[model samples]
Target: MTFVTKIRLQSGNRPALDRIVDEIRSTAERKGAELRGPHSAPPERLSVPQYKSTAGDEHRQFRSWDYTVYTREMEIVGHNELARQVTEFDFPDGVHVEAELKQVEQMA
Candidate 1:
């Protein structure tokens, strides 16, 4: 059987985020896991205060990210460690991080 883990991390620090992405990729490789998606794909969401707006109406911007990682059931490890490191890792000024983890099992 194969298993996968979906991880979501939020960091105001862009440099830290960049480094962790690489570290996670390396960790997954050492643990014989497959990581999908981009190392850093930035998606911005635009929202306006009023539902109806005309031309030249400015809106708020929100940023989010998406990533997919794969790993075998028995060979899985260090996800929490990475998350911990990410949380505590220091970066340039005005930076912070939050992480979320989800485990999934493939149906046989």
Candidate 2:
């Protein structure tokens, strides 16, 4: 049986996101882990409406705050140690991480 760890990272800060991804990539390279990629996804543009007061008034609303979120995804293949390390990484504030583990059984 083989396991695959899929890691997805998203943040509004591009530099910080890239830095973490680079760190993971370097560590995998040094440890000779089979890493799929740090593939980048298109920036997601989002907006939030600002309200001056809790009352629902159209005139009391402010301009929408717009932001872009960047995402990077990678997969660790058959290296449980490396995958665990990545999942347990101490990511800084504002960076969001999601990890999923899947078991793959070879057809014999």
Number of backbone collisions per candidate: 0, 0
Tens digits of per-residue lDDT for model 1, 1-108: 333344444455555555655665676677555555433445334333442335533463233343332211112333555445434645444433334455565566
Estimate, for each residue in 1-108, the C-alpha lDDT of model 2 and write its tens digit.
Answer: 999999999999999999999999999999999999889999999999988998867789999999999999999999899999988889989999999999999999
* lDDT (0 to 1) per candidate: 0.45, 0.94
RMSD (Å) of each candidate, 1 decimal? 9.2, 0.9
Give lDDT for model 2.
Answer: 0.94
Q: Which stretches of candidate 1 lie over 4 Å from their true place?
A: 39-108
Off by over 4 Å in 2: none
Error of 2 at 17 (Å): 0.1
In terms of TM-score, which candidate is strongest?
Answer: 2
